[model samples]
Target: MSEGVSIFAVGDPAGAQLNAAIRRTLFVLGEERSEVWNGVLQAANALRWRRMTQPQPRQFQTQQPLIDDIVRQAKRLRNLVSDGALLDLIAEAAVAVGETDSPAGAVLLQSIEEVGTDGCVVVASKAAARAGLASWLDEIGATVLVPSELDTVASTAETSYVVAPPSFMPSSVVTAPMTPEVTFVMPAWFGNRSLPSSAFGGHAEGQIVIKSTVHTIGDTTEPETAVAEGKEVADVYFPQPVWGTRSSGEREPTSDEVEACKVLLAGGLGLWLDDGDRIRSLDPKQPEGARVGYEAVKGIVPGTYLVLRQGETERGAMYDRAVIALGARARGILATQARWKARLDERLQLIGSRRAMTELERLGVRSSGQVRAWADPRLICPQRDADFALLLDWIGEPSHPTYGNAITLRRAVYKASADLRKELESAVGRADLRALERDGILHLDLPREGFRGMIVARVLAKAPFTEIVSRHHVRVPFTDGSAQWLD
Candidate 1:
């Protein structure tokens, strides 16, 4: 669409030859008019006519030629087409007949020679095909097979690769009697996918074949130190147990607690605390004032201690009002319960000494009925002038003549009541107090901690081992701090 960019030029012999090869290969594969063929033509045309606006200085220039771009695009095309063998043949033909005088082309040719054609079959899912995996295998000279055709050809094929989305069952795909290696390709920000060893084969150990050259999105290089490092990967791709504990002391978490954590994570809510400080630092947007205190789930080694906030259950519609009333009643009952009990105990002690009745008579001659009423824990009443005077005299506090002023007493009680109510409401509103009391507020002293501070963390931290919503590849971090894109 830009200046100097056009369809494949007609006059250039090398470009013409490359275009002819592509056309012939597509035709042989019955894909000449397919989207794959169109995409290839557009990619090749774009690269072949890509012109540099200005010549770089001699020192800055690197030996990147049109052939290299052709190969790169060819590899990417594997995901677009179903027939990788033909696509690879087309790419090889293009490289062989196209311009190759550049030093980079010479090196590429030599590398291709070293990686001699070794015949292997690749069975890829539709999702993997869209991710360009088939093309990549084809570029490496592997015969890519559709799932249906695998049953017919698998017995005779040597070394089969089964590539599928993380949620797929590898055993189900390769039902025929042949040893197959599996690779899970997952995309960015995907959730609810897990890779269990059981999927490979029951009881028998299956080899995990990892390709070092294939890189996916959000991948980073491995660190070269012994110290722990955090490499953020897509939440769904992180393969590690959710670390948690029941108490602040160091202890292992029970299976039920772990499952609860998984539920909380699935619901996309929970608190994540850093290991050292026990502070909420899961937010990436927050400024880095502390040293690296959080380790990714995949990088957590056994014996490391971590802190975590407990997960909350789904509350009923009346939860808020019920908690408020509970908190208010608790405050009122607790405030007087201890004082009332102490007063009763003291009265009993005095009665044993035959001084309680004398003291009661001195304080306005209280009868047995009055004593019984005052001692009742369930009797909640407003402070009256007589009661206030009696309490002051009984407690040996000097009574003031103006103590019963109506406005003063009203204002004092109103302020005290308001303050107490506010304090209780704030405490109850911040967290589910009932849940916290029933199922401890936080889990501490575990090996690893995850912050449910953001949506991504919640989806990943304790996601269940269930079917994936979508398919793609992601960079996975290991316990040793090394990482690679598992595609």
Candidate 2:
């Protein structure tokens, strides 16, 4: 990439580094700015970037047990980090939707089914919009409306119900037998996971809507608490059961076991070992087949191990945090690219010359999809050459190592990020105005007021560079209103 590209310099993002990167990205995007800063700072202080200076013991009488313990600790750490990342994303999304209340757990089917009757106005914030809340309500026969649309349709509706954030609750409503009542659907960190498609009863027209939920004994209402109280954990995060080494004896895995592994991978779960540093595959169809051994599956708890080895099931979280982080990273990467492409379109429409537009159109580069067509790295545009070259290079095809062809979109993000360092570095350099802050005769860092003069000199320098850096950099905003950049 480039000499000082933060994205390249940073290695495989794990633990604090990955967490910090994500927090930075969200801060720059104007999503959960305060929350992200606080979270990043807290993580930094907590981790202290320590390293184990001791050398490893080469021999062990029962190496499997030691391996198992390390794995367990690793998994716990990974789960916490992944959970935090997902929650942050949800929180940021809630803010984007302008939710007046906490946006947690509002999209759960249970929450929707309780009130989603025909003609009932399901009031919700924009934060709930992306989680398929409206679609779920419609599936159960409810008239869904945003908080803003309630005023126009409130008087015309049959049964008035508001699903708004507490601040947006309609105060002028009556509370008689059938009057409007505000129901708060609090965000939850854990609950009964959505059942597999096959177990979701049937979607056939005229079939009775069977209200069924997968229940497990000793299951807590929240995942964080459940993870803390491990045995009491019940999370149905995986659509299919996880499978592992047969407890019966040494034998070849059945096709069913292999398929179960495939399902877990598809669901963003993977076998982790050696303190979450190594990933093991459940796929039995690989060149060496499935790598099922005592060491391979050691540190997993009994309930979770049974699910993997015997196909015995549980309804709780049984995933590595690294795996979750990878999935999140994949999604974040693609979303950033998509947003960048969109901004390019917006920029072109405003400033692109007629000839530039025509040339781009001739090459079928009007949109992001078309931008992918001109894949030859050496190709250059006669106009908007920088943007055209960037889109070609930035948009890439990435495939997951385990799932092969299954997760194309996720891999795209992974692959693009893999190759994005140079572009990001270039963008950062383009954005830097430190040179302007210093005298040509005596180069040095500028003071605060001098920096302001340089900034005023070129306001336009910020926009395009910011857009490009945002596609790759995580910018952590500070209390002083400045940001720390990371990849």
Candidate 3:
């Protein structure tokens, strides 16, 4: 109260990534080595965590480690469009494929555009009418574009040439010159690039240049020219938006209100308990038949006392608290009487993972409320040690439930662990983080007493959020390079 109302904002915690990195570092250094080189290891671990939190792209002159392995995987998984690689391809295409007039090309580009390249992309082969590929695309929620309707297939080229990332095509597809026409030309790496093509295999060759894999149809003379001329392609990504609510504290009371509260709080509304436990009123006009003077003391007060409302004063707040408690008890009793407990339990059962729910039931926990008691975030992510396997085994087994829900809850925990790991490993962009922080501040509805004029005006002047202040609406954008509105 003395400090007045202070307004501060915060977001979701950020230690998960750092924590995971520390664990990894500890694992990498054996216990004996870790203890001996603890100081050096700790510094290195911190540096690694910082690097992960604030990621940047490296301009390597040659292929980095495992670049070949990555290319191999991409090639294996490319044509298997349903294997969660289409989205990445679509993203690359949107950023790389500038403008094309061909209908089939337009359609292919439009598919990525409609979803906005930030999300997953669905694609079908335009060269040959492959039912298997079409069905697979459909199963995986991607749209297949056919080239026949476009008449864009070249006269000399029997197969329509579509450009995709090299990583997404098979080695055979990458090396194949033309089945009458080159079916597709892929950037040796997982990307989209302008590639030369010929119908009769005059000068077509697939080459891995520098760090990327490229498939070409026409010239093998300067394969390196396939790389973008002016602008460098970067792999750096931004952080996700982190918005949170902020509330200000209450205002300080005036001297008059303080005095009033004191009077009202005295034995509560002029009713005091006697030695015999009898309730007595202080108004001094008790009627003959009235237990407490309801109508006897009506008209004599003239600014000599206080007026208390349940919402505004201590004495009235006491009664309010009693009423709320009674109401809660009554509601609980009514719910039990009406046999609604089972329905409520059924409702709780629908939250969280299905497998977790099943496991909880096996361990005699069937309700949402019960699940929370056992779902401690710490236990979900146990500490690492030589007994790590034993601990994990114990956690995986239902018979030895350390925590109430421990036996039934490893997959959900594991999935959460994996997600946190991925988030930690990924690069978070500064722009996205700034936008989210600014938006969260704008979203706040500060109490008049706590707003502190300078702060509000400063925020409004800085961000683009002021335009929509009247609407009280906001949209958080995705951190992906593609233009996308997350929510």
- Give the per-residue lDDT of model 3 (tens digit) for 1-487: 1111111111101222222323333343334331323322223232222222211112311112222322343455456534233323322322221121112233334434554333322222222122223333343344333332223322333333343322323333323322232333221222233333234345546633212223232222322213333434322111112121222124221111110100111111221110110111222112222211111112212112111122122222223333344444434333332232233223335543344446545554324122321222222222222222232232343222232233223343344334322322221211122222212111122232211110100001011111111110111111221111111
Candidate 2, residues 17-45: lDDT per residue as tens digits? 22233333334434333332333332222
Could you tell me the TM-score of candidate 1?
0.18
Q: What range of 10 consecutive residues in model 2 has the weakest lDDT sum?
A: 1-10
Each prediction's number of clashing residue pairs: 9, 14, 13
Q: How well does model 2 score by local distance difference test?
A: 0.27
Determine the backbone clash count of candidate 2: 14
Q: What is the C-alpha local distance difference test score of each model? A: 0.33, 0.27, 0.26
Off by over 4 Å in 3: 1-163, 168-182, 186-363, 366-487
Per-residue lDDT of 288-366 in model 1, one digit per residue for the tens? 3321134444343222222223332101111223334455454544344435435644654445313544666666643
Error of 2 at 338 (Å): 36
Model 1 steric clash pairs: 78-135, 79-132, 185-472, 186-472, 186-473, 187-472, 187-473, 272-451, 306-446
RMSD vs true structure, all candidates: 26.5, 28.3, 29.0
How does candidate 3 score on lDDT?
0.26
Choose 2 or 3, whichever is better by lDDT. 2
